[model samples]
Target: MFLGSYFVLSICYNLYLSFFRNSKYYPDPITHLVAKQSEALVDGFGYNAQILPHHAELSMKLIVNQVYLARIIEGCNAISIMILFASFVLSFFGRLKLSLLYILAGLVLIYAMNIIRIAVLAIGIYKFPQHTVFLHSIIFPLIIYGTVFLLWVAWVRIYAKKQNS
Candidate 1:
């Protein structure tokens, strides 16, 4: 029952985002926000970074030191990841107050991590363009997904245990 509802709600929310959240001026709000935050992070690290919206697609190009380092799309926003995280926590259905607080904290952590990931990827691409394919396609994804997986494991072992006890 929980799984079914989670899937339904997740799919519906994604569909709605696909249709209504995108625009010619920017990617979806979440993706745009991610791109902006990533740019800020990169800049803070003493790199010149800018996020330029793609004219023909739902993506933003991350420009570092006048070179295009990455295209941040909807998938990079971390919203889908958060949805998955929330669904799993909901399925487990721990204490109401604790679960809600955990979800909120987890989402914030994920978002902050994603910004850092994007900034690192941009720097990696800028400094090592030769390895762009491997870095973007493999290592970076593993980092994000691995973090999410660890968060899930921690929740099960820590917060969820409280409910069982």
Candidate 2:
């Protein structure tokens, strides 16, 4: 069940991504949405942030204070992560309705965290350009993966139903 769900979800997302790349949508909708949300979040933190679609790539360039900090690509949107998360939850020992609800909640939490992650990453890159590699390649990925791990642990240890002998 897990493998089947993951495969189907991944294929659907890949198709969606492929369709968006050649479509009229600039930078694709999810990437654009994530970039815009990050811009708003960063702006809320008093940073002058703006998102502009990158011409050469299907991504949005996140500019802070007129300096290019990062590019918000489709991968940054966290849909694929959510799909992996859903597959795991659905394959586990939980009631269908409850597991579905948990998956929904987990996805929302991850999506929100990804946006904040992008905002924080952009701010970090803008302020400390030297730590860009560490922050981007290490810290931020941990934040998102850690979120999924915690969600999985919660599902297994706290949410999953036990079997009766």
- Per-residue CA lDDT of candidate 2, range 54-123, in tens? 8998788999999988898888999999999999887884677777788889999999999989999999
> Given candidate 1, what's the lDDT at residue 84?
86
Clashing residue pairs in all predictions, respectively, total 0, 0
Q: Show pairs that collide, candidate 1.
A: none
Give the CA lDDT, 0 to 100, for residue 21 in model 1: 59
Q: For candidate 1, what is the lDDT?
A: 0.85
Candidate 2: segments with Cα more than 4 A from true spot: 159-161
- Residue-wise C-alpha lDDT for candidate 1, range 16-122, written one tens digit per residue: 68776546437677788899999999999999999998777778999999998779988898887888888887787778898889889988998888998899999
Best by lDDT: 2
lDDT at position 64, candidate 1: 98
TM-score attained by model 2: 0.94
- Model 1 misplaced stretches (Cα beyond 4 Å): 19-25
